[model samples]
Target: MKRKKILFFIYTMGKGGAARTLLNVMNNLDRNKFEPMLVTLNHDGEYEQYVNEDVQFIKLEAKRLRSGILPLAKIIRKEKVDIVFSTIPNYNMVAILAKMLSFTRAKVVVREADHVGGSLLGNLKCLVYGRFYNRTDQVISLSEGVKQNLVEKYKLKPNAIEVVYNPLDIENIKQQIEIGELSKEVAPIFNQNEKVIVTAGRLVKQKDHDTLIKAFAETNEQVKSQLVILGEGPLEEELKSLAQKLNVEDRVHFIGFQDNPYIFFHEADLFVLTSIHEGFSHVIAEALASGTPVVSTNCKSGPSEVLANGEYGDLCPVGDPKSISEAMTETLTLPPEALQMRVSKGEERAQFFNANKIVSRYGQVILNTFKK
Candidate 1:
């Protein structure tokens, strides 16, 4: 039997969630059963290093997305792809276009990665999503929370959307180490014998790096540790100013966009996420895989779900610096032996989101879509 040709599409490989998820899926999918291909709306950004040897990538020159319809149609027709999977927002529009123009019987699968802002236009998107999304045969969401949003806001048929938690490369996390002590090349911008707290994602309003700055500033003098944030974005200067204003600038280091965040995950003393909202926080899984103790905000959707309602990591109320400070201070005091025990728990829990399991779920969804 011939292998199914599946094309994974994304807007751009910008350093955040969707791009990383697609990159990991492409890297780990079974080559014998599926011929994976990729389409990037813009050729720019990282994660290209992880694209599989067998998978092909096309850099569509869509200066304005209006230009993409003709070109995207050409690629779908050329590849004769069986399925086109789109991630996040605008790219879904692009995938729908390709599906409309393709000569091949290509199905479209769109994944929703965020919950809040989406609901605003979600009703609007769902109208299109309902009219056309069902045309793809299936839609995948990163969390049950997001799936509920899709169903509630869009009145989507329950059967139309499947919740597949985003995958983390646990083997890579295990092999590489959570707070990587092995390689300085990808190390989180600072050398610290002190207790280390790490967070990864863009520095922005939603990520709430400012809350982390205030929390770290309040860490009692007796506790020895540093806070590190990974990823670069529009809020860089503002976050730096907030750190300086909070007087924790020395202790709060923003290491702009890292290609090798896994090393930081491996070696860190504790992992923390301060996001205001998320489809799912990928770093939390990375931290769990790294075996580092994790502290996070009880953000609306992803963190609470990923933590299994707080069994996997410590949860503090969102935007509360005092609570976050106390949590970090407590985690900082844990003995290495006890810390290892916590890390062991994380390793077991992280298996739920392991890369292969999630990718297989993705493949299965695409196949099931065609069955109907």
Candidate 2:
């Protein structure tokens, strides 16, 4: 029996959530059923080492998304790809155009990893999104909230969208935590007796680290805790300045990016995410898998769904430092047993997004697309 050929196209295999999620799906895909091909404009990335040997890796000659359209279309036709899977809006557009121009029998499946709030994009860009998104054989959303946004904000057909949460390697996270130790540089930060609050993401405006820093200041005044931020981005200096301005610089530690964040998650007392929006927050689920309590801005899409209306963890309004501060303080000061109960239940919730299960769902969606 011939396995279905799938071309997993993305901008780059960088250390981003979209890339990590795609890597999980690719690495975990059943070899007996699917032939996975990872295609990217650039071959060098943080995740290049993790690609499975059975999977074919292709790097395009073109470096930019626009320049790669014709080359991608040529590869799709030449490789006779059964299905083209791409994520992120720009990559999705490129994939759809490639499939359409390739004139092959390949089906196109685009995954949207961010909420498409109506006001976020310009009218022209929104029109383009609607056109290309509707042209695909199927659309995969990282969360139900993202699906709703695509349908309502972008006018995508509700039936065309399938919600598949980002796949998590729960067992791998456990192993990393079990075997990993705190590095000498960060070891001193964790040596203290104070409760540690951790938030990991690129230091970008989307993460709203400013709000998180302000909230941490408030929480610090009420409770003895340290803020440890993992991941590097352009906003590092600005965030650090804010921390200093708030007089929390001594307690706020920007540890930059980590090869294995799961270990930090396991060691931290609490995890917090203050993203302005997300299709699905991978860090929140990772925190849960590591048995760390979460305090997230009730951002559009992921946090509320994962937290189950604040049942498993605390949820606060987006951009509200006071609410986030209060939530952080409350969670930190919870009784030991109550905190353990939430952590235990959160671990169970994380299981729902295990790699095997979520990747199977994606495989089924690809099969259904082929049948169509």
Candidate 3:
């Protein structure tokens, strides 16, 4: 019997949530039922090793977004794919056009991982694309907050948009834990239990690393915990200068682009995320899975939802450094058992985003959609 084909469409195979989520779907999809393939706009980025070797990977050179969809649709037909899943914004716009052109009865799944609120330009763009988004067979958001945002801002039918949390490779991470401390095969950050405060995400305005720098600087220097920012991007210089201006230049370290980020979580005294807003913060789950304590800004949507309204980790007002610092200081003073409880809480919540479970949801969505 011929097998069904599934294609994951992505902007890039970069080390971001969208790419990682695409890999999660590819890795965990039942092989007996579906054959997985990856279609990426660009091939450059992290986490390439995580993609299953059985799956075919094809990269279409970047071009004018509209022009590229026609070619991408050609690949879909050539691959005989039954479904095309796109996770980036422009890719969604392209996915609709491509599938329409293919005329091959392929289902198009558009997943939005970016925070919809807190960005005027983003919300406006979503409005313009509101009517066209209906062309997608299904629209997936990472959090309920995003789901609501889409419904309210774009007047999308709530039923049409599904909230599928980002999948974390929990069992894989646990297996790597057994391998050794060097999970990523990358060198460790070389700091011993030096009260590390760590955050990992692209250095973008939404991540608000500059706010984290200010907050860390305000924390009592007597604690003297090191501030480490993982991941790299456009805001590196501005964030570094903020660290300097806050007089925490020597204290804050910008460790750009660590492929294996969990090691820092394991080694750190506290894991922190200062994102101004997020659709969902998958790194929080990773930190918990690594048995690390966490703290984050009470950013719209993800952090509070992931932290169970502060049950899993301490929450500070977004962009408020002193409040964040105070929360971190208080977290540092908690009893060791309390920290353990927090870690356990985070680990407990991590189950909701386990790789197999999330992948299963995708499988169900795909099969159900096709059945329709």
Candidate 4:
């Protein structure tokens, strides 16, 4: 029997949550049943090396999104793709438009990767959400909160939206954690006898690392802990300066982006997230799978769901340094037995987002696109 071909579209295969989740889905799909193809705007991302040999990879090399639209449509028509799965808002719009221009029976599934809340692009974004989004065969939302936002803000029909959580390669994460160790430069930070707190994400306004640094400063005053930020972005110098101004620069380590963040997640005493909003947080789930306790700001959609409303980890109010600091101190100070119990429960919670189970759900969604 001929296998169905699925083309996954994204802007780039960068070290972001959506790219990681998309790669996980592509690598784990049943090869016998489906042929996976990845299409990116250009071949400029860290994840390019990780693409499976079985997956057909293409780069349009378009300088911008508008320029790539025609090339994408041509690929859709020429390859006779059975389905097109696209994530991120702008990319989603491009995929939908490309499918329209292709003029083929191939289905298009646009995945919404964030809670736009109707303000991201102002009127233009809202118009696209209301017009083009519903026009697609299906819309994949990362959480119930995102789905609700679509319906309320954009007035999308509920039946057209499906809430699909992002998948994690939990087994590979555990393996990497087992074999991975701290580098020579970073090893000393872990050896300082200070309770190590780690957070991984781009240093941007959305991540709200400013609040995290402040909270870390507060946590350090009482706990003798250190903060290790694992990702890099525009705010690097500013954040480092904040740490210095707060007098915790000696305790804060900006290690940039590590190829294997799972190692840091596993070795750290605690993992924290201070994002302003998220579709679904892969890092929190990763920390849970790594057997580390987590403290996260209760963001719009993902964290509360992943942590099960603070059952598996502590959830504090967003952008509140004092509350976050209190939670950090309390979680770090839990008794050994109590901490172990929470970690065990968190490990179980993380399994629900495991790739093995979540991939099949995506497969079903892809199939449903054709039916509609």
Q: Please provide, for model 1 over 1-372, each residue's C-alpha lDDT reduced to its tens digit, 9 standing for 90 to 100.
A: 577888888777768778989888878777776898888766687778767777888889885666777788889888888878888767777788777987667877888888754555646766665566656667888998888877776677887789888888877766655444634543444464567778888877998888888888887465866777888889999888887887677777777777777777776788888888888888888888777789999987888898998898899999999999898888888887887788899889899988888888877777787678
The residue-by-residue lDDT of candidate 3 on 261-336, one tens digit each, is: 7767777778889988888888888888888888898887888888888888888898998888888888877798
TM-score of 2: 0.97
| The best candidate in terms of lDDT | 2
What TM-score does candidate 3 reach?
0.93
Model 4 / residue 242 / CA error / Å = 0.9
Give residue 292's lDDT in candidate 2 (0 to 100): 96
Order the candidates by lDDT, highest first — what do you get? Answer: 2, 4, 3, 1
Off by over 4 Å in 3: 117-121, 178-193
What's each prediction's TM-score?
A: 0.92, 0.97, 0.93, 0.97
Off by over 4 Å in 4: 118-124
lDDT of each: 0.79, 0.90, 0.80, 0.90
Which parts of model 2 have CA positions greater than 4 angstroms off?
120-123
Question: In candidate 1, what residue range of length 10 has the lowest lDDT sum?
Answer: 178-187
Q: After superposition, how far is residue 210 of candidate 1 from its true place, in Å?
A: 1.3
lDDT of 4 at 349: 93
Which of the two candidates, 1 or 4, achieves a greater lDDT against the reference? 4
